[model samples]
Target: MASPSNYSSAPVSEFLLICFPNYQSWQHWLYLPLSLLFLLAMGANATLLITIRLEASLHEPMYYLLSILSLLDMVLCLTVIPKVLAIFWFDLRAISFFACFLQMYIMDCFLPMESCTFMIMAYDRYVAICHPLRYPSIITNQFVAKTSVFIVIRNAFLPAPIPILSVWLCYCGKNVIENCICANLSVSRLSCDNFTLNRIYQFVAGWTLLGSDFVLIFISYIFILRAVLKFKAERAAVKALSTCGSHFILILFFSTILLVVVLTNVARKKVPMDILILLNVLHHLIPPASNPIVYGVRTKEIKQGIQKLLRRGM
Candidate 1:
């Protein structure tokens, strides 16, 4: 319905990320805490990866899957946090057009990849608990390798169209993104052209990818819970539950924050824009920071691995 003449002929070369304009006066105070969170996420995941790599006793399918998760978390933190800290600390918020799309693409791919990894980890636990005998064969190193490949291909290739589609949309002058990072929706909405298709694809792709993973994870946990309940020995049941406790906590926090962000956005009238933006930013940080700590504290092998690494370092 809008005429082509109404839109500017010049292309948008860059975008300004307006990170929480409502709190501009005091936003610099966020620098210390956000920098700390970023460091914690990077350090924790790095330590977990190192501990797993150095501990040969941990060279199993479960720990391999955990290593994959740690890698994803670290990559995700690295991709999003540094730019965010730049915005908070030095007021550097300009992102080139290509870089913005690249960030959007990476976030699109990695967020769902992380979800898929969690689902695979859930499946690993389900097999370990429900069919311990078959776990050795069913969840072999080969299985992890295959699943890792599948996760990479499925997540990376399927979401490739999101940013591509966004690129086709004409941005006729408005180049300000309201969020900290180049989130898909935040960046897409800036286009002067009609972006309904972009919105539709993003919604469909996101729900189809993340929604199905969540469902499969839920089913896996249900089976795990059923299997744990059936164990005749109380100690066996407790051990089984303990094995899943950390994973359960991690997924719970991840899904809960994601769900809250989605709900707040859907009901944006009631939620303040600053709060919504804060939630989106924290969602990226909190999970990565907590994941390694939860697993290290709850899983004896990882705890011991970390301890061994610490002792060797000291």
Candidate 2:
């Protein structure tokens, strides 16, 4: 008989997503919740986008960033969740190579874009609260437009080679991807060819993009805290604290989930594979789900816009 490495001479045109827990009949129960999360996320984000677009009063730097965040959250949800629900509900896991690469590209690219967005939002807050007078000049319409273009270009180009590298890899062995979505490692691990480089590159690229963003955001918050503390007026200080609360809570959730994922990935041997799989799925879904509820609905202007829209409907 041929050696183990020799078994995969035929090409891999598709990958089978094994999905979480691997519970055949029981997995059907998961469809309702997953669909609900998708619906909630998409509906909320779309509503926020529409509110921002229709309201001229919301056409400012802060609301513009929120608009971008809402858009990103919607795109992020669409990229990974629908196929996942299909896999869970219908057991339709087989994804063609081109489609898989496209999914991988969107997954990799959009996440870093999310990180960039949070960082940019932090900076916007810093400028607005710390230097109110100069805020209008500093964080202008042109600045927001430029930053949006930069975020798109940076993330689109930087993580692009990752999916391309995966596409080029020869998957000669079993083509089963043991995850809900086509993640970089889950798919590359199936390659008969060694994928050591892919893992290392992804690790480095992930940390570099997300890590730097986190550090910068932390620094921005530090300055924000300092500025808030310097204000002698208690009411002003309280306003600043309240203003940052919702945004920070959402950011904290985003950061905490990502941190857990990193810790769990590093400790994969000790943790159950199913748990790891669940964490991976939740990492993509939770933040998107949290976006509209945590940030959009909580924002005063968005709530006002919603009320206005409802009144108009009446």
Candidate 3:
């Protein structure tokens, strides 16, 4: 433990991100796969954005929501992956204080934004299936525009205090971050001062934002399921299920991985550090990589739009 007297020394201006120190010799092997995922996330989301923009028929609320998701995924990938790759490929692990905090802020903000997006998407499906007539009125392009603004503002401002609180801590002793990213917990733990406030805020804010979104999404899906079950025609039921199946799969993937990471962290002593670190890295990369591909393969409208775009290019 660092002495109380040492806490008064100069605060750290930079942090050394020791990414996967236990597997240092073999960690370089991760570079290729992570890089590929980064490229895939960028390319696939770009394609989705272009397809949605060019296809006049796709200028609707659902596709607009998808475009928002793609935009979020793209920004997330851009923010984290490049620096991660630089660290792996060039052995550049030093992150300046401001940059580290900025990364933490963005990660904290955008993750909840993604959760809120999934909740909005669930509501969109619920309206379409449960109140088909009202959906047209309720889920208009204007409504989606407003929802987009809400998501940005809610997520941006709500989590702003996390990184800000972390910045106020005095990190005078150790500047080495164990994980690849500047996660709030990892960064704040190094502080010389009592970081109980930081930890409490992080826990309360994170669970509150994500937990509320999850509950709403669950309620929306329950209604959707009931409406689908009430369908008289077998074809109508199947069609409704097909429409929601893609979104459900994505929600499952995103939420399940997150749950596992959280549980493992709670039982940290039992779980290997390398495994936890790898899970965190994968949580960031895999969803962005898979989200577009899942929609492209499963959604008929997006598939056709991609085909049309390709044909036009050729």
Candidate 4:
């Protein structure tokens, strides 16, 4: 007979399994690479934020936005990676209700905020390229600060209803979450109740905010490309494109990976699911690591400022 301690007599509240199955063996080597990547990403993004804030020379609109982006990326990483690493390290499968809710909310907050920030950055580029003469007047420091505040407030409150509503939904049935993380999709799928409204909200948010943001981003880049082509000097065109190159690359990479994951998951691709999920973790972590380095490499102002900071330290 099994001991009472060994069995969950509480009707087995929930069974969350992140691993694929018994036949699929776990890879220990994957953890080493992942940990290295996580540390490097966190370090690079943090360094970028510090370098920009500490260096007086980086006090420009572009670098200011870059600093904000780095901060957001850090938030993004914190929301997902730490819990993931913990789960891997300790082989923990279950999370408390409050902890799960907090994780969901934080992830929700960062996702929308990051998208909004990118849209704002697009507007910044639009102003700089489209109306250089009025750029200063249009995108005033006050306006940027206000917009940043709005980004936080908008996401912080808007996503509150989502997790709250979901948590309250009936889960009296089997509570086995098949994903690596406590994803909204998996949670909603677990519920025995009608999740039509939840699906509607997900679709609307994905298509409207996320989808529209991407569209607007492309439009801004289109105009930017036009502006670049019109530049009389070769150097001017190269410089203008270079200013946006790193960000555009990162955006494209992330968007492509995200879209692939969504489609594959929706289609129920079993074999690639875990691998894609792992890649999603990398996708979240890589931006922070690469963002700062991209700016540091591309922008003279940031480069000079970082150099100055290092000199002072030495």
Ranking of all predicted structures according to TM-score, beginning with the best and ending with the worst: 3, 1, 2, 4
Residue pairs with backbone overlap in model 1: none
Q: Write the per-residue lDDT of candidate 3 for residues 151-178, one digit (tens) a residue.
A: 9999999899999999999888788888
Worst 10 residues of 3 by lDDT: 1-10
- Return the TM-score for candidate 4, rounded to 2 decimals: 0.89
- Give the Cα lDDT of each candidate: 0.89, 0.84, 0.90, 0.73
lDDT per residue (tens digit) for residues 220-247 in model 1: 9999988888889999999899888999
Candidate 4 has an lDDT of: 0.73
Which residue pairs in model 4 clash with each other?
Answer: none
RMSD to true structure for each model, in Å:
3.9, 3.2, 3.2, 3.1
The candidate maximizing lDDT is 3
As a whole number from 0 to 100, the lDDT of residue 159 in candidate 2 is 88
Model 4: per-residue lDDT, tens digit, 1-314?
Answer: 22113233244355463633332346434567777878888888877888888987777777777778888888878877776676567766666656665777777677777778888888888888778899889887787798889888987887666777678777765555555566676677767688778767766765666787788899999999999999999998887887778778767766776687677667765646666566667767777777778777877777888888789889
Candidates sorted by lDDT, descending order?
Answer: 3, 1, 2, 4
TM per candidate comes to: 0.95, 0.95, 0.96, 0.89
Prediction 1 TM-score vs. true = 0.95
Structural RMSD, model 1? 3.9
Question: Which portions of model 2 show Cα errors greater than 4 Å?
Answer: 1-9
The backbone clash count of each candidate, in order, is 0, 0, 0, 0
